[model samples]
Target: MSQSAAVSPSIDLPENKSGPHTSRLGLITVVATFGGLLFGYDTGVINGALEPMKLDLGLNPAKEGFVVSILIFGAALGALIGGNLADRYGRKHNIMLLALVFMVGTLGCCLAPNWQMLGLFRFILGLAVGGASTTVPIYLAEVSPFEKRGSLVTRNEVMIVSGQFAAFIINAILFSVWGEHEVIWRYMLAVAVLPAIALFVGMMSMPESPRWLASKGRKQEAFEVLSQIRSPERAAAEMEEINALSTNGDSRPTSSWKDLTTPWIRRLIIIGIGVGVFQQLTGINSIMYYGTQLLQQAGFTSQGAIVANTLFGLASVVGICIGLMVMNKLDRRVMLLGGFVLTTLFHLLVGLSAYFLPESAAKPYVVLSLVIAFVFFMQGTIGPLAWLLLSEIFPLHVRSYAMGVCVFMLWITNATVAFVFPPIVSQFGIAPTFFLFAALGVLALIFIGTMVPETRGKTLEEFEDEFKAEYS
Candidate 1:
């Protein structure tokens, strides 16, 4: 193959390979995914706990929002620092480090005495969430076979939603039994610590990312790691591919800022950012973050809305599973386009129904149906696809920094939407809130259709060749 051809190479794993280590990869996935679990629990715990949390903390709309959104801001900062840390310390080491942060953040939140303390702890929790979000998927993607990469990395998302569901159920049971006990929120926050411990313990047995090892000139170590996961013949071949790409590939860029100064790199970063923003702007988090309280305002009681909120989490989990099933069978660009278009329609219908209907018997179910549809479409399409694409795009040399910057923008946009959602619904009503999300959804569809390229079935090196073709 020509050098340019080698730049964007793809491979098929051997049809009849077996090993002691196949299950080992699955084990590693479970370990790394604890980050996702903690993220889900920490973020979603507030949904059910919000009512009691508010009354206990004396929260008004603005302070409540700040308390809710503080973690996202912490996540933004965490991504920035964690990306650099992973790049410097190695993926495995930083993952272990992040688990400790997760524990501290969770414990802090659980022990918080007031809203101010809660915000402070949640910010710390965001750091862990952001770190895991960036690191875990990349770790899984790097370690997984391309044939199985999409499905494996998406487990992180599945775990995330599952954690959310567990939180809702736990909160419901606790609330029902305890009925406004002084510290019910603590139980909700404290549950997250289990996942943190799992992440830390799991990392103790996991190997470092072989690719990261190779990037730093540890070829022998890379081959050793690869051999554990691949058949001997396959492992040897894989190493050759990595060696060719990393050693003879494009010279490593000195700074991430260079991607901004350079045209192709800049465009790729922009596309990645669009994916991140679109993923959030679909209003998925709106349901996850405020599903209970928002539904209560729409006419359900506190307990009723929370029980209803579980359905969104459940739908999202199921949708992403279907998405993982279709990943290798379909192109990512198609998923993004089709998902957003349907999501746009759903949001519009929900807004119109909520707007026109009296706060009668039918309106809450209608809004609930719309939220369910949005979550389902989001998970099956944009949810898993966005995360997979972000992990795949960008050159290996600049992947960490570029991903950090893009995800930073993603977190900020998420925080902005989350912060405004409660107040917006309070001021303008549910119909208008859904209407605004629908408008942004339309813009996102246009952006994805025009700007984002298809990345399915391509190798990382081959994707780089695309950079030269598109902007060279």
Candidate 2:
């Protein structure tokens, strides 16, 4: 930003805005975040449907894993393409397109006649999933006030886990009511359509990402968008700040992958990738994807396992709410460190309990409670914060590129965990599986202590200036 730009008034959101504006902001968040809901529901819905899908389709371990992971592979491709698309067309518009793909994917999954067909459709769905996971946070962060950005963007993460929980409950109910039915997996797959439509129509009425508009040099449109989310005092101030940042022809590059080979961009990409990969290695999603199996091993029946897994999702929502409360108050580094410590302890306890306990009925319940505690620690500490950092760590011109590259790693790591977790349990059993996760948890604690920076109370403009000074 220029000296004149730095002199512009800092934006301060209303401490006394009317409830209607708040509701509008909330509505925008909900619509944009539906992208995340579908992301969670589609991926998580499979956990329950897996057994039934496998039984119906006659799949073995390998094919079953394929059926589960094919979407992730498609998501990787989707992230790359979607990032470019969002950067080009506009965030809200791209999200609308993604919602359509999500709807079609759900329909395809519901109507798939065979495993091969299902894998193909899941891949299609993944494209939308991957797209939403990358675009939604960027959209939310760009639209939100710096003070509220972390919480706003993380709302998507909260919705994601909540959606997964909802899918689990809905699946469990459908399974019970329609027990002994062969096509029940079809119902499980179909549940995602309602939210997909909600996302599509909701996005249709929403504004484009404010930052994206600024990046595109549509200053007037960007200001109008800021108006909807901010008090008039703040909206005008943010418009000036955005204009200042865009002075050097927007500082938003439209470039090929080869352009990202610059040293600084490369380093930032690595940081983003670290942010993505580390979040997953913490093994939070293992609970989302395979918690039922883990609970069953600890000795719960099928019904009991589904009921127990819902607690993790509920804990995740609560944890994210707390996380949002403290997000701006705490540094990203503090949250990461504290989260690592808390999650590590939970993992250790989970492993120790299972290692010492016999196959008693109480063991499953104990493990379920531990899973709940683990999620509470995980979501409150690492889950919401990781994506927030990832969204902000890159330079302005390369933000989308850096995010897409990084989130690609995120989804891949997720796929690895989801794909290998079941086999790991079968081969080494639950004791070693949790132990391995616990050990990785320790490594994560060490990683956070040695690296990661504090980024709070800093605007994107301030962040760029600070990083430029540090690196120069």
Candidate 3:
């Protein structure tokens, strides 16, 4: 993406005071983000479960990495097609299907007869995860008023982190109670099934995205859905805006994969892909998925590390909560650059502490603090903001499709990092691994500084116009 650098001008939208329907909007957000909860639990469970699983399945280092990273490969595929599925079916329907996949996949993994079966089941679970990563944010963004869009859509990220925290807590409790029980990992994996059921039942009552309805020319249906979420006047106003942006005009272009090849649209999609790739390469998910392993390498015992890993998850939850509260007040570019800088420093500190602390009793706790700081800065800034921008940056016609492509790249990058991480640490040690991440973080900071556009408070329509100017 060329950084031609258009100066951003914010558009002031009409004030939309909260109404009686605000509670209804909150309900929908909570229900939709159950996808995120399942996304979090399924992915985070392996961090704590990997050891017991290894003992039970006789997994070597290479096989263990495959088992852990295969789900991400499946997620990459899921994200690749998830957009077309959401548009072809409705977003709510696709999400409900994902919920069923979550239940079946969790049960399959919990009851797997061998490592092979377990890997298969985990990939199945990843399908749901990848789909949710794309669909929930778009659904939330479309239903939300522009003023509340960032917080509302980011609520999914919050749920994702909260789900991971819940996994850490459950894993710790199970490990403490069961001690060396071989099947303890099964319980951790199976707990995700409960939220899958919740997501399925909850989405049954949720409405489809009104913006999607308008895109399909079902204007009245879209209006009805909007009225349920927005005040009467604001609902009508939003309906007008959606209609104006819809495909009613003879000059309006069709949304398709082919449109992605257009010069202007291609640049926007490139930017979206950059956003996704940078978010993953920052190495945040490494901690989310492998915190216990990292801590043990730092000097803690396995059990102690599993218990202490909960702190990482807890800090993530807190950071996401803070991000949600202050998200509306910040510029996306500024916050992202600041986050990358902090994460780079934290990574360097973690590497240096491990290299120099030298077999001391205090080394583990000291390293843990640095990791915790990294998690806080990450989840608080780039983690939530990345998903927020991906959901908001694309035009209404191509929103879901573009987001699918972006997240597909995100999962692929995530999988690459996860797959290579164990081998890298094994060959280079924890200090050198972290030093590599720190260097990558520096490059990611440069990418954000030069390439990403500021999307704070901009309407989807306003962004649409900006993209159109490239073609005009």
lDDT of each: 0.82, 0.80, 0.85
Per-model TM against the reference: 0.95, 0.93, 0.95
What TM-score does model 1 achieve against the real structure? 0.95
Q: Rank the candidates by TM-score, best first.
A: 3, 1, 2
Error of 1 at 262 (Å): 2.6
Model 2, position 396, has a per-residue lDDT of 58
lDDT tens readout by residue for model 1, 1-472: 1212122245443532767778878888888888888878887888888778888888997888788888999999988888778777788998999999999998998888888988998999999889888888778878886667778888988888888888888888888899658678888788888878988998998999887888888889999998888778877877777777776665353336755557888888889899999889987887899898788878887678878888988898888888878877777777788999989899999889888887788889888888898889888888878888888887766777777888898899899888878778889988888888889998998898788877666666666666657686
Summed backbone clashes in each candidate are 3, 0, 0
Off by over 4 Å in 1: 1-16, 251-255
**Comparing 1 and 3 by lDDT, which wins?**
3
Give one digit per residue, the lDDT tens place, for model 3 in 186-255. 9989899889999999999999998887777778999999889988887877777666666434123245
